[model samples]
Target: MDIRPLRCRDFRILMTSGVVTMFGSFITIVAVPYQIMRLTDSYLAVGAIGVVELVPMVLGGLWGGALADAMDRRRVIVLCEIGMAVLAAGLLVNALLPDPAFWPLYICAGGIAALDGLQRPSLNALIPRLMKRDEMAAANAIQGMRWQIGSIAGPALGGLLVTQVGIAAAYAVDLATFVVSFVLLAWLRPAPAPPGAERPSIKGIVVGVRYAFSRQELMGTYVVDIAAMFFAMPMALFPFVADDLRSPSSLGLFYAATSVGALAISLTSGWVRHVHRHGTAVLIAAGVWGAAVVGFGLASDVATALVFLVVAGAADMVSGLFRQTMWNQTIPDELRGRLAGIELLSFSIGPTLGQMRAGGMAAAIGLRGSIVSGGLLCVGACGALARVLPRFTAYDERTSPHGRAETTEPVQPADPGQL
Candidate 1:
């Protein structure tokens, strides 16, 4: 809503690049699953996609964060874009094979996931360098909007492309997006490592982990999100919920409901810039997300269920905006990437495990029961967390030491070893 951040040339370039790449990335996301289903026709094989990408994604995120801090962040982003483009080309070629190799699909998917992990930390960590600290919420909101566009339109268009044209066409589009992203990223100013920054290593990563845990506020962000996602994220149960509602055809609507809500929030996020008690804001928003999920679970009809999902989605966007602002406002620039990497894992691991949890619980209980219970657990977890970490709940941007220190000295304690 606040368009002030868009005035910066580099930020504009970066955001435009993100919009293009995310759109393409989502296209490939839909295409890959459809291709895999066509080739194997096994639910187990389709499920294995997550398993295949897991380890590589985790390692890539941690190491990528280290890499972002060690070298030029811009260079890291550019190189990863190139790598992803090559992977997309591979997907395109494989899709055109006389008998497309199933293994290559998995291979390419895993490879692309790794490149995504590698690229994101640098991408996120570079934001503060491009915008004034006070503009972080607007910047984060714009980025969220960019992602929502991809999530909503990319799949719709990709489905049409795959169904009407071919899988190869979808991959070709994804590859083109990477090319465009690379060009835009090339225009970004250099974001070099701090003078005393150490090369990326196992030790450096451990130091980053240690620093994150040492700060209660940072640790609170990670754990609270993990709890919220692990319990309340119920995407894995959408199909079952759709069936229960007797509107299996409306499955896509169920998926889109949350995105629609989140997009609405992103489009009208001007008010977020005024709220400085980020920790409290996150807690409230996450709790609302959980409550909405519970409402969704209790809804017996498709329309009611969708309304709850929309509310849940809007709440999630609010939490994400505040969480990101907290990170950017307080984190020292030198260690931003590594912290972002840990931040990545905290958010990523939750949804992955949440899907697994949803399925397991759905099997153990009825569909509605799983959704209801998870939502209750998510809400309860937030309350418990607030009680346990009072400092996090009380965090105020105006008076917090981290925020003050970041404003006064943008560069400090460059060496992880010294921490």
Candidate 2:
């Protein structure tokens, strides 16, 4: 198959924005929980932050997705970035306050999450407009690579900055990244609204919801992803592992190992492009992820746990590649933003619910037992999805409906007047 990348100028701007945003986002992810821990010295308080963040993210994704479809996508992204920048500045101010209240931290985190909800779908919808039909896979691969690279660097850098410089310094770095991202986004021309787009309204939001749920393949992907995240999220247990199973230093080591594994797979972008049965690859990777989670739960030594985490990250990277490709390719340009919103909603809900469940189960049954049970259930869920969506297992990129390799011609640029 002949695959090329998006050559459009706006796509380059958006991709550059993604790199900066991901790095800053990762830094915040590391710094936030650590800051909460230091302030309250309570695990429940940290978990509460997750809950607060999830609510706004899910709500914003639905509304944002609808708005993206009805308005100019580039403008929507810029507005979202600006909101994020303001929130980051607020965090910096709060840090400097004489008595930084816990409630303020929670509010800032929720605000950031809401802004991200708006940002994610707009960006996902913009990719196809930038590329030829045949280049969707490669474009998605580049996105996956960018995410993994940011994930690899962000936490380590955040940790170093917080440990050496201070927590406030980490937030300042994040604030700076948002500034750079906003500047890049400002340079890009706006993406034209889809043909015949209507004025934005609540009815438009309902329409997007209706369109997204109507597609079988898209719905199937959502089902599988929700199932995977609900049963497999191990984030709630990280602190326990650091405190009980290993030293605090080992926590960073474990995260670094996982990032390295993901980075290794992402760097081999060429290899991912060649995979034919992408859906099957996703299923197989999910199974590996389950097994690795189980292995980590049972591991007695820090070395063994780190090894299992590396395996889990590798499996995660593979699964992410296929899942992203499936979503980006199957959705139509007109509905991509809303569908991406629905996708984000489903994605966020699962982990949010999972963390609550994990925390509760760990309290009742013990951390190891909770981890083991979740992993086992995840593996079983994958098998169940395979049986139900048997055709999904047979999906091949070469035979895509958008255009098979033999039938699809390169996209001629839209008329200069239209652009």
Candidate 3:
């Protein structure tokens, strides 16, 4: 991966903070569900965690986008980090209680989800300010690697801590990570609102939404990603897939396979900076993800199935890298936060809906049938989207008007204000 972005002091600080927080955040990711399952023993109650968090996250993303545009981006991130730390404390305290209440899990989970939604648009929007535009692909790859590392390590450690030491220990570790992240994030330079940026309002949010839809290439990214995830995301079916393949003990591998693949790509992502046709890259990656899922479905052995899943994961990582690059390279600073909000939804909502789609389809068809059918549908959707949105596929970063604008007119920090 390109290391030029790391040369910037602010970028280094932000990346470090991200690395610490992601590890803590992911530990909580495992703890929340585990605690809920232990307390209620109801799959429905555990599943309802997603439902409970969804609305708040959606509202938070929209409002947070507006907030990021209206305030100092660094301040927004710092405040959210503090809020998250408080939530982590809440979880820690509750876990320490002799008789932990069932309801607190849902409350903390929802609150954290909202805060995460709020913090992310600011975080995503802040990246361009931290480094040169040409280094974005490398930066994105590095960030992706950070996430995969956290996803893989945090959960494993979380499981071990929760099971061996107790749930309170897991929450404590998460809380500590937040405190460390807060201090690091506090050191970053101010990223003030764009000049003449309007105060966050429903009207402003609507305008952002309108702008996102008005751009055909932007729409292509959103629609293609949604379709790919909605049709091909099979996490909900992983346990069943393992059973079907007669490797129930290897179920964890199914979950880890994609991350491993994504990590491998991130490790070797130097070539990504050479690619100019980001749109084409995303389209190809999504199609490959679909194809890999189909191959996974058809595979009769665990090793074969895992190979396909890894390919799918790597493809998804490629798609994500370019989608992020496109948004960063094309979007105006004034609208970056709000667009990042929309970008969050395009990626977040898809997987939620996808699991639902997977479960419903698996019941309607058999396991392999659901996986196979969904993969086919994903590919078909990509083909249809490509035909309709030719401009997106033809988009070349070196020559596109938006990319040219980004290159010619670099972003400048607005006058600093009190955080």
Candidate 4:
């Protein structure tokens, strides 16, 4: 196969299961918001539900890393998948109730968030263990492709199912996909804990955090992502923006537009494998993302705004690919799970906080003002990070200490003519 990572037996199985689970997760992403809206008829209610899950998710992910380092990664993922499925079933039962209440959703959301926190690190850590180091860039690109497609199609499909078949049916679809993912998970052989790995404990978690903090280049990745998401994530303000654009019906389009751009970038990602300066690439892509978000805020028309959003998504995908490559190429297998936990925090918590920030900004100045100011701040923050962490900007995979050492060719008898 041209895709080198997929040639490995383990990565393929994990990718299949992960992709399926991703689609299922996206369905819930839509279903939860729609359910909240139906239950309370308030945007505040919809937003609050996300808040409920944020803390548990953050904690679960970090702690899960400790467990992953101490246990079999495959087992951790499978168990988390089971936990998530059970939680989804709970939501389904609640929806079926004659008088569906809002409270149970909070509990379910928290539970699922915790499971997600635990599962993601193990899965991410599994990729490097499953594939060759040099093949990591392509593998990351493929993962980006799957994620972009799932983000785009999942919400669109979820909206369709909820509107036509009802919320219960949507939940049923999510639950079914979980079963499929579980079966796929079962097909993979055990990915056991690394040799000399410490037992899961608070001290273990602390060590992971300290190691992550010790790496300046890695810190750059995490902090830059957080700044970009926190300042420029505009999802919370999309509905208001859509109304202003006089296309209230195009809310779904707004939500899916970024993924469209991301998908486009992913399909033609062969060039990334040849790039040696991964950290520089990450900084550049993150800059582009910030600029695009700024453009999105300033655009008056729906067409222009959608165009900006697409650019932002494409930029974000590029940034993500480089970051994942760095992680896969550099990290020791023993530290992989713990580091993945920190990575999860950057991507997940940033957006959660971003949504909250977007809401506040929208209320403070105006919808457009929020978008423009946030985007501008994102650009500034990223620029500052780049300046403050020059080490990351100068990091070239060709010279990176963390990169795998090159294998020397065995000497053979000189050509007869040369001899």
Candidate 5:
């Protein structure tokens, strides 16, 4: 719904590249899991993929953050995309073999995850540079819509391609998307290193971590996000959920349904500009996500379950918009990338652990019990986060010293209609 950011040439160009890459990423998302099921036919085996890549992802993110601060971010993004495309090609070649081995899939998956970890902080830190400071929240809302569109279309189409032509076709399409993205990226004007950036090193990463820790407001964003994701995410169990519904073909729908909810919310996100208390919005949205997941766990019908997933997805989009706005308006340019890297870890680690938790608990308590209990725990964790991290809850864009530091405009109360 927020369309102003597109007026900037650089933002539009950057978004064009993002749109293409996201489509490719979602294709890989479905292809990898579906391929594992075809090969070994075990939920635990599919879940183990996350575990294998966790360390690589953590390292890539931390190191990538430092690189973004100390080098040309545009170059880093292109290099990472090249790595991703090469890995996709690996998958394609293996799918062509007369007897494709399972291990190649693991290798490709792990490689791609690591590259993605390296790429995200650079991409995230680059966006604010492309647009005005006043447009931050709206820009994030628009970015969320781009991801939602890819999320909705990619899996549905990826599933069809995999089921019809084969995994080779899906991989081929994914590889092609990366090609278009690479070409687009090659033309972007460079975003050079910030002035006086320290060399990329573990010690540099530690300094970033320390800076993030000292600011309780920033920590609030990280803590609440980690808590919600670690406790409530059930995406790793979707195949089994589809199987329980006696509709294996609906597996892709299970993934896209959440996007449907998120897209609906993004279409009307202009109201977010009026919100002065971003931290409060984040917690409220996350609590809604927990509640919706609880509904999904209890759903007896496929339609009901999909609806609940949609609500959960909407809540997540809202939370992400506020969280990103918090980062852009408060953190100075020199520190943005390293902090974004920490932000990347907060988001990425929680989902990885959550998937592992979901898969293990599903094996023990049954899928429904695992999901329901996890949702309840997510709600409790968020409540605890709000109480303990008062700084996050009290973070108002209007008066906070941090928000005022880098803002182009002084915070002011606006008429509900004018913001």
Candidate 6:
């Protein structure tokens, strides 16, 4: 299995867009919570904003996936990007107002989150069309790297900009990035819509959901991911941990440590081509992740917690690479958009619900206890998933049941109007 770098022109464009978008997104992540806190001075209201965003995000991905299957994916992505840009500009204007009401912010957050939901699936679907079959893992690794960078950079940068300048300045930066992303997307060629697709409707969404669940392997993967995220995720209680173990200022360091760990793994992912049994690798990674979470929960000092976080992040990066490759290769091209959407929805549910659960658990049992319980549950969940889906756990990447070759040569750039 030969792995190629994303040296293709369109892939380069997409990668550049990712860089800009991630930087801008980080700004918003920081600015939104800060602004909301400044306005209401209530932790409850700030927390409510997260819930407000999650609803639209899940729905948007579902609907967007259906639309991507029905229409040209490039068009779907471009439209979403444009909508995102408009929303960012609106946020900028709202920030400038003498007394920006909370309702408008909520509305904007929901809209942006919804648009992001659509953007993610469409983007994932488009990647396979951009690259060859064999390149999926490598492409996903690169994509993972982009996200790792964004996750690390976005929050810290947002905090700096918000603290030094203002929320408006951070938003302005986000708006600029949206524009750049849109321009790059515009330059890319369109991808073929899922064949035999009709107009977008509720029925179409249903069809997509059915198609996604029809596959045992894909369904199994979603189940495993959901279990991991729902039980192991401790992000919501990070603030509490920071307060307990260190100053608020040191919170960003923990985030950076996680990102650095993920980045280190992704940078060396080229060596991953040597691994024959991706499924086994995924399970090992998941187990390690669970152990790291347990360690993190018990850590009394910031350094110990950070060490656990880095390990968790590294394990997560490896799992993500294999999982994404499995998804891209297993699904048919026609169902890619819809399946990707369903997958995205499943992905969102676990983390969102987990965060909410973490918050409540922390309040009830103390941060360390809540985290420890979550970690234990995570290990149990993974074990349950493996036991229930033994066939899926034994699946090997060397042989795909799908008609397409298990591996293929690199893909060439498509004509702009081919889709």
For model 2, what is the C-alpha lDDT against the true structure? 0.78
Candidate 6 TM-score to native: 0.93
The runs of at least 3 residues in candidate 6 whose Cα sits more than 4 Å from the true structure, single-residue gaps closed, are 1-3, 403-419
> Tens-digit lDDT track for model 3 on 216-319?
98999999999999999999999888888888988878888999999999999999989999888999999999999999999999999999999999999999
Over the stretch 1-419, how does candidate 1's per-residue lDDT look in tens digits? 89999998878989899999999999998999899999999998888998988878888999999998898787788888889999899999999989998899889889988988898999998888877888999999999999898899998889999999999999999999998888777777667776678999999999899989888888888988999999989999999888888899989888888999999999999999899888999999999999999999999899899999999999999999999999998888778889989988887899999998988998899788899999999999999999998889999889988861232224322221211
lDDT by residue (1-419, candidate 6, tens digit) is: 23375666777878889988988987898788788888899988888887899889989998888887778777788888889999999989999888976777788889999999988888888787767767788888888888888988788788888899888899999999999888788888656565576776788888877876676666777777777778888887787788988678767787687688888888888877666566666776777887898999999898899999999999888888888888887777777778888888888898888887787888898888888898888888777777877767777777757533222323345454433
lDDT by residue for model 5 (1-419), tens:
77899997767877898889899878888888888889899978887787767777877888888888888777888889889999999999998999888899998888887888888888888787766767898899888998998888888788788888899899999999998998877776667777677889889888889999999989989988888898899998888888888888777677888888888888999988889899999999899999999998898878888989989999999999999999988887777778888998897888878887998898899999889989999888888888998989999988888752332333232222210
Q: What is the C-alpha lDDT of each candidate?
A: 0.89, 0.78, 0.89, 0.84, 0.85, 0.80
Candidate number achieving the greatest lDDT relative to the actual structure:
3
Candidate order (lDDT): 3, 1, 5, 4, 6, 2
Q: Report clash pairs, candidate 4.
A: 61-117
Q: What TM-score, over all chains together, does every model reach?
A: 0.96, 0.89, 0.96, 0.93, 0.91, 0.93
Note the clash tally of each candidate: 0, 0, 0, 1, 0, 1
Q: Model 2 off-target regions past 4 Å?
A: 1-8, 243-246, 402-419
On residues 126-243, what C-alpha lDDT tens digit does candidate 2 reach at each position? 7766776557667776777678778878988988887788888888989999999988887766565677777766787778778756655556667776777788778778878878
Off by over 4 Å in 5: 39-45, 240-250, 363-366, 404-419
lDDT for 122 (candidate 5): 85
Candidate with more favorable, higher TM-score: 2 or 5: 5
lDDT of 3 at 325: 92
lDDT comparing candidate 3 with the true structure: 0.89
Candidate 3 Cα outliers beyond 4 Å, as residue runs: 404-418
List the RMSD of every prediction in angstroms: 4.2, 3.9, 2.3, 7.4, 6.2, 2.8
lDDT, residue 305, candidate 4: 90
Which run of 10 residues does model 5 get worst, by summed lDDT?
410-419
